[model samples]
Structure formats: C-alpha cells, structure tokens
Target chain A: MRIGLIGTGNVATILGRKITAAGHEVVQVYGRSAIHAQQLAAELQAAYTTDMDHLDPHADLYIIAVADAAIASVAASLPLQDKLVVHTAGSVSKEVLKVASTRYGIFYPLQSLRKEMEQLPDIPLLIDANTPDDLALLRDLALSLSTQVGVASDEQRLKLHVAAVMVSNFTNHLYTLAERYCQAEGADFSLLHPLIVQVAERLQYMSPQDAQTGPAIRYDTPTIEKHMALLEQHGEMKELYAWFTKSIQKQAASGEL
Target chain B: MRIGLIGTGNVATILGRKITAAGHEVVQVYGRSAIHAQQLAAELQAAYTTDMDHLDPHADLYIIAVADAAIASVAASLPLQDKLVVHTAGSVSKEVLKVASTRYGIFYPLQSLRKEMEQLPDIPLLIDANTPDDLALLRDLALSLSTQVGVASDEQRLKLHVAAVMVSNFTNHLYTLAERYCQAEGADFSLLHPLIVQVAERLQYMSPQDAQTGPAIRYDTPTIEKHMALLEQHGEMKELYAWFTKSIQKQAASGEL
Candidate 1:
C-alpha cells in the first residue's frame, strides 16, 4: 500500500516511519517546510513535496497528519477526489477530510509521540470512515501498524480524546506539580518514583476504582484537613487538591466508581 | 533483631511477613483481637499477645502498624521505654511515639500495600529517627526489606504524602472517571489501556512537564470547549475537566512546568 503523508511533526514522522517499517510504502511526504519534508522523506526513502499539488496523485492513501487546526485547509487544498484521505487528529471530525476526497476517514492513533523516544509503545488506532471499503482500508492500515484497532464515531473519539487528556496530560500535570512541591520542601522527589510505577502497574490487574487508596478514598477528614492546611500557601494546587478530594468523595458516595 | 508488630491490617501483615522473610525474628504480634494477632504470629512463626502489658519487653524494635487514629493511644499504652519504637503512618509525626519510648521514629513505606500482593515491589522506606543510633538501626532494617530507603523529616514526609495523593490516588480517580465516561458513551474503555500504560512508561525516561501532551497542555481552546460541552451532563467530571484544563493552562503560562 502506497501512502502519502501530509506533515513533518512528531506524529507525521513517527507514523510515517512505522508505516514504512511495517512494509507499506510511504511514497510521498509533504510539509510546509521543504527541508523537513526532504529530511523525513529521505529517511523513509520516499519522495518529498512542499506544495500540496505536488503530492503523489497515485498513492493508495493520503494521510493528513498535520496539526488539528490545519486539517481543514490542508484537506481543502488537496487535489484528490474519490480517493481515500484520512486525518490523524483525535478531536477533529471526520468530515474535515470530506473536502479533500469522497472517501474520507480518521486514522487516529491514541498514543502520545515524541521524536526522542527510542521506540514506540503499543498504539491503539481508532478508525472511522465514510464508506465500508474505506473503513476496511483504514482498519487494514491500522492493523499493519498496531494489533489494536477499533472503529469510533466522532463522539466516541472526542470522549476518548477527553479521557486521554485526563489520564495523560492532566495526570502528567499533577506529577509536575508534585515534583515542584517536593522541591519547595527540599524533599527528594525521586522517592516517589517506585510508588508512581507501582500505581500504574497495579491497573493491569485491577479496576481503577478498586486500585484507589489514600486519605480521600478512605474519607479520612483529619488527614485531608491537615493536607489542606499544608497546601494553604500553594494556591494552584490547593484548589485542585480540594476539587479532586471532593470528586473522589462524590464518586465513593455514588458507588459508580 | 527481635521485632514486635502491632496491628493486623494489610500494612502490618505484609510488612511483618516481609521482615520475617528477611531473617529478622518477629518476636510477637499484638492486635485488638487475640485471634487476629495469633493468626499473623503463626504466619510469622512468632508469639502472639493482645494485651498491651504482655508485649515483648525485650524486642529490639516495636513497630506500631495500627491505624493512624490509634497510633497515639497505642503508643501511650505501650509499657516500653528507652527502646526503639516506630509507627508506619505517613502523615503522623514521630512525636506520637514519645509516650511509649524516648527512642522513637518513623518507618513509613511510600507505596500502597494490599494483602493480596504476592510480593512487594521496590518499597521506598522513608525513615525518621530521634537519634543517630536509632536512625542507623531503622535504616539497616529498612535496607533489609528494601533497596530504596531515605531519611525524611516530618515536614518532608507530609509533603511527600501530599505528592503521593496527587500522583497515585488522584490519578487513579481520573482513570475511574474516564472508564465511567467511556461506559456512558458506549465506547470500549479497554481501548484506553495502551494509552494509559504508555503515559506512565514515558515518565520513566522524562520529567512529567516534558511528558505532558493533549489539548490541555497545548491550550487548544476550541477542543477544550468542545470537551466541556460534551461533559455538560457529567456534572462531577465536568467541573474536574474544567479545573484540570485551567490548571494545565496556568502551568504552561507560568513556565514552571
């Protein structure tokens, strides 16, 4: 399967490399920067194009792996019609690609990507298409890069994106705040490393609700009040601490967790 | 070392088992219930006593592994003096043990413990002592059970407890909420597993601030608003989603992350 990739960022670079490594041909790479396109295309042994019109008209799939905001304009400017085109944004609607081709879909990979990563972890692909044939094509392409693939509607994808934010971005922010708090107290933050890893590993064998621990889940008011008092100087974290504490308590009370 | 353990809960049971397995003699086990203490003592091949006056008077260290609320009462009731005593509560001050013995300290393990765990992971023991001799004794005992051990002040331990709450308890709650949201939307919650594991794995190689990715970190207002609108029906999660989003934006703006 020949593929044309439209972007030169982390997702585009990582996905393009993985697709090529999986024995698919990344036939053309397009980016706003000619040099970046050339560099990535050179690595993938694919042709390079800075202009949208110069994208290979013959590739089997055109993947617009650009920024979410640029997807619509990139789709509109593309020269393809009645051909498979997909955008990789998790939050973007599949209809954004409709202006580029009659057969459009989403080939969203639900994992964070970084250029410095030595190797990619398992990426779950969430695919959606306008037609059965296109859906099949996207599924096959996703399976080539990942064993985990599923069809998702725009609503499902948006919810998944929100979940991703909660687990990844928001979770990481908490870690960041924790590290800062440790530094403020002149405590060794590294002591928390094994604890953090253990918590994550615990999820493999148990539901998150069952995995929950600490003062909030137990509703130990004295401990919670003590922590609140300690956080009085930490304005950002204090409010967040209270809000999360209340949410956990509410979940416990509702028995939905 | 002849060790006397107090309490029969998860922490006491697990820690007692590990200490005995590490070649220390669990001289006696004491709990509120005679049967419970006997059961734990039998597992450790040690003596059992429920009466506070009957605690092993000659044990090298008396570890009070009871609930945080019971620590003070248990400490006051103990007949030991000028012998090393320690409590395993993270938030409690070491002074709680002063009534039991002048030689008192803390033996707080940083990881969440459960009775079902077959073997403990790397438990980072945070030790605090009233004297250098007692500190060395506590450190040696900690090292016997874990490779990771550090001395932490009461203030530092409280801060660490706060950090642990943010990273472990709060993070797990977020996962719980995400799974619930997935269920409500009829989306496959299992699809988020790989992403969750990937986010955790990334932290092993980089700092959390560097690891943050998603609309929250990027401050994608349109995506944030869309997510907020999707979460209108989920009152608890809606507020949490908004708070986390604002926190991420603030972190990014302050450049502290």
Candidate 2:
C-alpha cells in the first residue's frame, strides 16, 4: 500500500517506520515544518511537502497523525483529490475531513508513542470511515499492520479516549504526585517500583475490587492516621493523604471497592 | 528456627504457614480470640492460646504479625524470657516490644498479605532490631522465608511505607475509579487492561520519570479540560482528576517530573 504520511512527529515517525518495515510504501511525508517533513521523507525514501497545495493524491492513503486540534485543520487544508484520508487520533471525528475528500476515516493506534524509543506494542488499531467503502479500505490497511484492529464509530472512539485518559494519562499524574511526596521526605522512590509492577501485574489475573488492599480497604484507622502524620511535613501530601483516605473509606462504605 | 506466631490474623496465618513450610516449628499461636487462635493453630499445626496471661514464648523467634494497636498490648502481655520478638508492621516503632523483652525488633514485609490467598509473594522484608544480634536474627529469619530482605531503620521503613501507599493502595483506588466509570458508561473495563500492563512493563526498563507520558506531561490543556469535564459527572473522579492533574503540572513545572 502506498502511504502519504503527514506530521513528522513521534506517532508519524514510529508508524511510518513500521509501515515501511511491513513492506508498505510511505510515498510522501508532510509536516507544518518543511525540515521535519524532509527528514522523515529522506529516511523513508519518500517525497516531502510543507504545503497542502503540493499534496499528491497519487498515494493510496493519506495518514494525518498530528495533534488532536491540529488534525482537523491539517485535514481541512489537505487537497485530498478524492483520496482515502485518515487521522490517527483517538478523540477527533471522521467528519472533520469530509470537506477535504470524498473518503475519510480515523486510524487510531492505541498506545503512547515516543520518537527516540522503539517500543512497537501490539496495540489495538481503531478504524472508522465516513462510508462503507472507505471503511473496507481502512480495515484492510489496519489488518496489515496489526491483528488487534477494529472498526469503531466516532462516539465509541470518544468513549475510548476518555477511558484511555483515565487509565493512562490521569494515572501517570497520580504517580507523579506520589513521586514528589517521596522525594520531599528524602525517600527512595524506587521502593515503589515493585508495588507499581504488582498492581499492574495482578490486575491481569484479578479484578481491581478483588486486588484492593490498604488502610481504607481493611478499615484500619490507626494505620491511616499514622500514614497521615507521616506526611505532616509536606502540605500537599497531608491534604491528598487525607482526601484519598476519606475517598477510599467512603467507597468502602458505599460498597464501591 | 522455632517460631512463636502472635495474633492469629490474616498475616499471622499466612506467615505461620510459610514458616512451617520452611521446616520451622510454630510452637505457639496467640490471639485474644479463642476461635481465631484455634483456627490458625489448626491450620499451621501449632498450639493455640486464648488467654494472654497463659502465653509462653518458647520458640527461638516471636513474630508479632498483628494489627498496629494490638502490637503494644500483645507485646506487653508476652513473657519473652530474652527471646527475639519482632512485629510485622510498617509504621509501628520497634520500641513497643521493649516492654515484653529487651530482645525485640521489626520484621516488616513490604507487601499485601491476604489470608485466603495461596501464592504468597517473595516480599521484600525490612528487618530492624534494637541491637546488632537481634538484627542478625531477624534478617536471617526473613532470609529463610525469602531472599529479598533489607535491614532498615524505623525511618527507612516509614519512607518505604509512604511509597507503598502511593504505588499499591492509592494506585489501586485509581483503578477502582476507572472501572466504576467504565461500568457506568456500559463499557467493558477490560479495555483498560492492556494499557495497565503496558504502563507497568515500561517501568521495568525506565524509571517513573523517564517513563512518564500523556496529556499532563505534554501539557495538553484542551485534553485536560475535556477529561476533567467528563470526570465532573462523578464527584469523586472529578476531584481526584483535578487534584492529580494540577499536581502533575506543578511537579513538571518545578522540575520534579
């Protein structure tokens, strides 16, 4: 399959490499910045473009893997010439590209991407097209790249995006907070590594409800108080510690845990 | 080593089984409740005592694996006769057992222990005693059960305990939130399983700082707002999402992440 890859960002670069490795042609690379586009094109032995006016519909597919907000703008500007176009976004709708082309869809790869790192996870590829014909083409393309590919509507994708943020993005922030408190107390944050691994690993074999363990889960008020007092020096920890303990206890009482 | 397992609670029963498995004798199982003491003793094939006054610490090592409050009272009731007595608690100070005998310490296992579970983790044990001899004794006993052992002071164990809450208990609560929201949306919570596993796997090769990803670290405000608004429907998630996100951004700004 001939592919026109847009946005020489982390996702584009990683996916482009994978596509090229999988014996598919990355015919061109497009970016807001010409230099970034050219670098990726040179690596993939493809053409480069900075202007949407220069877009060639000669390629079988145009993949817009830019930021969520920027995706619609880029898709809107592209001179699609009736080519099948798709954006690798979890949140954006397929309608964003309706004006730019006769055939449009979303081709989202569900995993965090890093430019320098080469972690090609066997992630789920969610594909959605404006029309049935476009969906078939996108499904074929998705299947070539991954076994865990499925066709989902915009609403389903949006729901998934919400779930992804809750589990991945939001969870990482919680981790960052814990790290801060640990550092402030002159504690070795590495001590938490096993626990992190344990939580993640156990969830595979057990439900979160069954795997739950803590002061609040066990209803150990004395231990909870000791933990709060331990965080007395750090103001933020003190507040968060109190709040989370209450939340857990509340959840426990409500049969949420 | 001969063992005197005190407080026939969840942790005590689990530890007693492990001790007996390692060919150590659990000569005495003490608890305030007779049924509890007898059940544990029957399980471990050890003797049971309901009366604290009738307690005889005949084993080489006395393991105080009970609740935080009972640690002191149980220790005060014990007639150690110069035997090594250690409590398996994170926040509890080793000084409590001084009332029982001069030869006492803390044998804190840094993992969640459920009585009904069969597969026990090779937990990292934190050993601390008043004297070098007691420390050696405690470390050796910990080593006999599992090789992952550390000799830490009260301060060190406390530090690890804080990290434990962050990674295990607190993180698990976040899992509960994710599961609840997913269920509310009539979505399968299993969708987040792969994401959870990926996050944990990444930590094995990269430190938490380097492994950090998502909207908060990228400072994607629009995505953050959308997530918060979605979480707004659930009071707990909204508050937690706000607190965790704001905390992450602040930490990133302060060069913590």
Candidate 3:
C-alpha cells in the first residue's frame, strides 16, 4: 500500500516510520516546514512536498496526521478527489476530512506518540469511515500497525477521547501537582512512584471503584482536613484537593465504590 | 529483630509475610478478633493474643498496623516501654505512639498493599524516628523488606501522603469515572488502557508537565465544550471535567507545563 503522510510532527514521524516498517510505502510527505518534511521523507524513503498539490494522488491512503487545529485547512487545501484521506485525531470528527476527498475516514491511534521515544507505544487503533470499503481499508492499515482495532462512531470516539483525557491528561496533571507539592515540602517525590505504579497495575485485575483507597475513599475526615490545611497556600491545588476529596467521598457514600 | 504485629489487616498480612521472609522473628500477633490474630500468627509461626496486655513486651519492635483512627488508641494501650514502637501510617504523626514507648518511630511503606498479591510491591519505606538509633533500626528493617528507604519528618510525610492521594487515590477515581462514562456510551473501556499505560510509562522518562497531552493541555475550548455537552447527564463527572479543564488551562497559561 502506498501512503502519503500529511504532516511532519511527532505523530506523522512515528506513524510514517511504523507504516513503512510494516511493508507499506510512504510515497510522499507533506508539511508546512521544508526541513521537517525533508527529514521525515528522507527517513521514510519518501518524496517530500510542502504544497498540498504536490501530494501523490495515486497513494492508497493520505494520512493527515497534523495538529487538530490544522486538520480542516489541510483537508480543505488538498486536491484529492475520491482517494482515501484520513485524519489521526481522537476529538475531531471524521467529517473534517470531507472537504479533501469523497472517501474520507478516521484512523485514530489512541496512544500518545513521542518522537524521542525509541519504541512506539501499543497503539490501540480506533477506525471510522463514511463508507464500508474505506472502513475496511482503515482497519486493515490499522491492524498492520497494531493488534487491537475497533470500529466506533463519531460520538463514541469523542466519549472515548474524553475518557482518555480523564485517565491520561488529567491524571498526569495530578502527578504534576503532586511532584510540585513534594518539591515544595522538601519530600522525595520518587517515594510516591511505586504507589503510582501499583494503582495503575491494579486496574488490570480490579475496577477502580474496588481499588480505591486512602483518606478520601475511606472518609477519614481528620486526615482530609489536615491535607486541606496543608494545601491552603496552594490555591489551585487546594481547590483540586477539595474537589477530589468531596467527589471521592460522594462516590463512596453513593455506594458505588 | 523480634517483631510484634498489632493488626491482621492487609498491611499486616503482607508486611508480616515479608518480615518473616526477611529472617526476622514475628514474635507475636495481636488483634481484636482472636480468630484473625490466630490465623495470622499460625501462618507466620508466631504466638497469638487478643488482649493488648498480653502482647510480647520483650520484642525489639512493636508494629501497629491498624486503621488510622485506631492508631492512637492502640498505641496508648500497648504495654511496651523502651522498646521501639512504630505505626504504619502515611498521614498520622509519630507523636501518636508517645504513650506506648519512648523510642517511637514510623515504618510507612508507601505502596498500597493487598493480601491477594503473591509478591510484595517495591515498597518505598519512609522512616521517621525520635532518635538516630531507632532510625537506623527502622531503616535496617525497611531495607530487609525493600531496598528503597528514606527519612521523612511528620510534616514531610503528611505532604507526601497528600501527594500519594493525588497520584494514586485521585487518579483511580478518574479511572473509575472514565470507566463509567465508557460503559454509558457503550464504548470499549479497554481501548483506553494502552493510552493509560503510555501516560504512566512516560513519567519514567519525563516529568508530568512534559508528559501531559489531550484537549485540556492544549486548552482546546471547542473540544472541551463538546465534551462538556456530552457529560451533561453525569453531574459529578461534568463538574470534574470542568474543574480539570480549567486547571489544565490555568497551568498552561501560567507557563508551568
């Protein structure tokens, strides 16, 4: 399968490499930056282009792996007619690619990709298409790069995207706050690493509600009070702490946990 | 070391097994329930007693691994004098053991322990003692069970305890919310697992600030609004989503991440 990568960012670099490694030909790379496009194109042994018009029209798939905000403009500028064009975004709808091609689809890989990372994460791909043939093609392409693949609607994708944010992005922000709090208090932040990993590992065997522990889940008011007092100096952290504590207690009281 | 365990809960069961495996003598086990104490004592090949007064007074260390609320009462009831007494608590103060023994300390294993786990987690021990001798002894005991050990003050422990909640307990709650949302939307919750693990694995190489992704970090208001609209039915989750989204945006605006 010949592929045309429509960006030179982390997603494009990593996914382009993976697509090429899986015996698919990344025939063309397009980007706003000449150097980045050339670098990615050179690495993937593909032709480089900054203009959307120069994109290989005969490519089996055109993957618009650009930033979310740039997807619409890129899709609009592309001159492809009926060729399969897909965007790799979790939040954005597949209809965003409709302006570029008739046979548009989504090839959302639900993993955080980093250019610095040596190995690509186990990307559980979520494929969606306007038509059945395009859906099957996206699924086949996704299966080539990942063992896990599923079909989902635009609404389902958005819900999963929100869920992904809750589990990954918001959770990481909590970690950031914790690290900051640890550093401010002169405590070793690494002390919490094992506990962090344990919580994540527990999800494999148990529901998060069943796995919940600590002062908030148990409603140990005294400890919660102490924590609240400690975070009084940190406005954002204090609000976050209180919100989570109340939320946890409310959930526990609701007999959900 | 001759150790007397004062509880038969999850911490007691796992830590007792580790202590015995580390070549220390679990001299006695004490619990409110005779059956629980006897069961744990039998498993560890130690003596059992339901009465606090019948505790082994000559033991080198008395470990009160009970509920946080019961710590002060149990410590006060202990019949030890000069023997080292420690409570396995994150937020509780070492001063709680003041009535039990003069050589009071803390042996806080920072990982969440479960009886079902076949092997002990990489227990990062945070020790605090009134004296250097007791500190060394606690450190040695901790070292026997795990290589990770460090000294922390009561204030420091409280801060870390708060951080632990942020990273572990709060994170798990978010996972719970995500799972619930997935179930409601009829999406595969397993699709988010790899993304979840990827976010965790990124922490090994980068700080959470650098590891953060998704609409929240990007301050993508359109997607945020879409998510908010989708979560209208989930009262708690809706508030949580708004809070985290605002917090992430604020953090980003502050140039923290």
Which scores greater on DockQ, model 2 or model 3? 3
lDDT of each: 0.87, 0.78, 0.86
TM-score of each: 0.95, 0.88, 0.96
Q: Which of 1 and 3 is the better model by DockQ? A: 3
lDDT of 2 by residue, A1-257 (tens): 99999889888998998898789999889888988999999999999988878877799999988887787778768887688889988766789888779988899877766666647766678899888988888888788887777777876776667777767765666566677776776666665666677677677677777778777777888878878878777777778778878888788788763
Rank by TM-score, descending?
Answer: 3, 1, 2
Candidate 3's clash total is: 0
Q: Tell me how each candidate scores on DockQ against the true complex.
A: 0.75, 0.50, 0.78
Candidate 2 per-residue lDDT, tens place, B21-103, comes to: 88889988888788999989998888888876676646788898888877898788787758888999888889888998878
Give the per-residue lDDT digits (tens) of candidate 1, residues A92-157.
999888788889999998988876677877889999999998899888889989998989999889
Can you give the lDDT of residue B204 in candidate 3?
75
- Model 1, B1-257: lDDT tens digits are 89999999888988998898899999999998988888998999999987888887899999999878889999999888798999998899999899998899999999888776766777899999999999999999999999889898998899899988888888888889888988888888777787777777777788888877788777678888898999888887888888788878888888773
Stretches > 4 Å off in candidate 1: none
Residue pairs in collision within model 1: none
- Lowest lDDT sum, 10 consecutive residues, model 1 chain B, at B113-122
In the range B1-257, model 3's lDDT, one tens digit per residue, is 99999999988998999999999999999999989999999999999999877787888999999999999999878878888999999889999899988899999988777777756778888999999999998988898888888888998888888888889888988998889878888988888888877777677778888777778877677888888998888888888888888878888888653
C-alpha lDDT of candidate 3 relative to the true structure: 0.86
Residue B13 local lDDT, model 1: 89
